[model samples]
Target: MKINYLELKRVTAMHAHEIQQAVNHVVNSGWYLQGEAVGTFEAEYAKYCGAQHCVGCANGLDALTLTFRTLITLGRMGEGDEVIVPANTYIASILSVTENRLTPVLVEPRLNTFQIDDRLIEQAITPRTRAILVVNLYGRNALTDTIIRLCTKYNLQLVIDNAQGHGLSLPHGTLHSAALPSPSVVCHSFYPGKNLGALGDGGAITTDDETLATLFRTIANYGSSRKYVFDYCGRNSRLDEIQAAVLSVKLKYLDADNALRRNAAQRLIGEVSNPLITMPSAEYCHDNVFHIFPVLVKSPDTLQRHLQDHGIGTMRHYPIPPHQQACYQAWAALHLPITEQIHREEVSIPCNQTLTTEELTHIIFAMNSYDK
Candidate 1:
């Protein structure tokens, strides 16, 4: 009766065969760095996202940082420019804006969806505002259409931080971003446990702009295109051949796996109705892959204790909002009542794609039994 939040999909014998084939091919190919495997993986991933191009990287944080740096390289943004972001997002979201020496303006997210409150974005815009870094928290997509409209109105870039939302869009994000160009970017994290997770950390930036995509590649590879020539000071952040190969195989099943996660989430909502627990409502959003089933509950401490004692594993998406953290305190004075409340009550339940019906029921029963 012990279950961690999620178990990675089994690398069954067949999966292992594919991985072994890839590994053996890589082993003798003598072309590991930026080789055929990397190139093939990039092409396949781009096709998967419906984007014109995809550049793989070492990790999610690097993917986010490269997106920001690429904007600056294209002269779309620069130092002293400001990037608007959600206060309730993962720290990596904020770090990306700051890593590029740009200012980060934190805005409160909707309590229900935990996405940046679209209503408050326009008012936060100033002359220096260059882009909006919107995150699809847990598994939900933000009101990206509304965000696109606002970006158009303000002439700002829309950099999507989809660390927790990989196969999240399936096909929608590419189509949506393709509808508009030069002001939109959708980045994905293939970190382990993600909808498109590799065996290790990885990520990609999807965009229709060939120029921006080109620049992102340069940034991810030490600012050099020809190995010896350096375009600018960039970081070493290339996605490994082994990971890329593994990801190619995983990408094939992402959609079906996401559907499984979604189904489990629906059942959890249907079964859990304690007045103390608040389940996320997707009425306002589009698609979700349930990266985490975060719910609000009274006495988070007692709930965590009770669940843990009963062999049910649970955790907080974030116990503290980013703006309140000490490193970000210089500009953290902004009041975000909704964000604060979310931090206090939010607790993530076990909703991994690999979860079985019996396992899921065990968790639901434990949560419900707490009331009695």
Candidate 2:
């Protein structure tokens, strides 16, 4: 019994008939882009996130880029404005800021929560800091109460990269974090592997501000609110009808599916009590959807190989920190020890919705069996 890291095929198979119907409907509709399907999904997703509006985009990166671009179009942010972001986040989070010509001030994460340390955010802020890009890394909320207050005290816009956290929410509500931010914008990705994944690439931006929402809609559509009337120099990025329709179907089941992932995470946290391995803190369990179950071990490579020997597939969430990447030559000398250690030690095991009880047991046993 081979246990793959994420069985996307099984995920799709879970609702194949429903998804097929939605795809067939979109195919027969003849109105692919900017159609009713996208509009309906946008509205539905906004309601789900407790936001007033949602703008669908082609992919997650563009969703983030357009949010920043919308701020820039409105004269809120501009070239070289510093946006504090997580150093341990996926490269896309950093890319979104740099792609818009905004300076990314990478902040280290709280080793316990795997979230941006709110205590450190104040130190990173300067007069030029226009926004804080808080990422919900590994489906855990980082926009805590302190970070929200910091955003208010410093008058910085709060932008969330919620690409990994589709169905996740604080116990109080989606709006309230344990100490969550009053975010100005939250971006989502429906990439095939995401919690609320579409068949292919998809993304959306949710916001309460009407002006920003309208601007995001315009910017995502090649800077046009109306046909052939360009307002800003924007690129083309749209969530097609099929992906929107598929996402709409999956959105209905997100919470239920997330529950399964959480169960798996809890089991792992409870069962894998090896002293050499460090599982994520269970403190934010209620707030997390467990998009990827990350475990830190002394030798990530050896542990990964050990799991593979047991026929259980695993992957590293990231092998390289963004700052150390070849592209950022100037920041080569900058040392972020915490982020670098996380990059080296983290291993992402199967925590998706499709794992069977037997597979889960096998994985837990394999993890506990690792001697080296």
Candidate 3:
């Protein structure tokens, strides 16, 4: 009755044959970097996201970094300009901002949804604020109508950190107006464990702006637009051919896999009831792809140990708030109670497409039976 938090091996096994074939094709093709495979995945992924362009990079952080860097090069934003971000998200989200010499205005997230509070964003906007980097934390849609309207009214650039939320769609009939920035960008990551994972690290940025896409590709390729001709100071961050080929295969099953994740998550939400455990609000659950099915408890360490004893596994989505991290010591004094609380209490249980029905039942039973 052993249930690991997320067995990537089993997940990979589901498509091993196709993945192997794709990788083999790449190895035999004699061209790895910037080849047909990369081009094909980029176009397919862009179409999947309803964007016109997709620029592949080495990893998720690079995707975020290059997006802002490209925006700066286009004069859409510049150094020291502020980008609003969630205080509770993984450090990579904030790192993307600081790495570009841009300031990150950390806003707390709603405890129920574990998403950046759209209500708090407007108040955080100041003259220096240039963009809103919305992270779809834990595969949930973080974009709200309020945030979109604010972005429109203030003329701020909208950037989406979709590292955890691949295949999530905006609410029907949303984002169709001329007021919003044309070609709004969404960044994606294909780390080995993500919903739309590759065998190795990979990422891409999707946008309708041809200029931004070209610049992103150039920046990721050591700032070279043409052969040996450097445009702007950039670095090597191109998605390799094998990973791109693998991703192209996985992309076809993403929606179906996400639906399976949703089914498992819904069962957990509806069935798990414990005084010591608090589940996320169901309001966003239907829309969420359930990258991580998180729960709050009084003692996450104790719960983790308890689950381990039961041969069940668990992980913390995060245990430290970004603001509290020592790297940003200047902001150490900032008090964000909600964000701190989430970091202290959150634990992610198994909720991937790889879990079996028996395993899922065991998880719910183990959770409900816990007296500690």
Computed on alpha carbons, the lDDT of every model, listed in order, comes to: 0.80, 0.88, 0.90
lDDT of 1 at 295: 85
Query: What TM-score would every model get versus the actual structure?
Result: 0.94, 0.97, 0.97
TM-score order of candidates, best first? 3, 2, 1
Count of backbone collisions within predicted model 3: 0
Predicted candidate 1: what Cα RMSD to the true structure? 2.1
After the best TM-score superposition of candidate 1, give how far the Cα of residue 92 lies from its true spot, in angstroms. Answer: 0.3
TM-score of 2: 0.97
Give the Å error, residue 217, model 3.
0.9
Query: Where does candidate 2 clash, by residue pair?
Result: 143-180, 144-179, 144-180, 145-179, 145-180
lDDT of 3 by residue, 266-366 (tens): 88988999989998887868568888888999899999998898899999989989988999999999999999999999999999999888898999999
- Preferred candidate (TM-score higher): 1 or 3: 3
Per-residue lDDT over 1-372 for candidate 1, one digit per residue giving the tens place of the 0 to 100 score: 887766555523336687778778878877777887778888988887777888889988888888988898889999989999888888898898898899998788887678889999999999999898888888787745677788888898888888888766633454334555354778888887777787788888887778888889988888898869998888889888888888887777778878888888888988877777777775623577788888888788888888888788787888988878898878567678888898878898988667789988888888887762
Off-target runs (Cα >4 Å) in candidate 3 are 173-180
Better of 2 and 3 by lDDT: 3
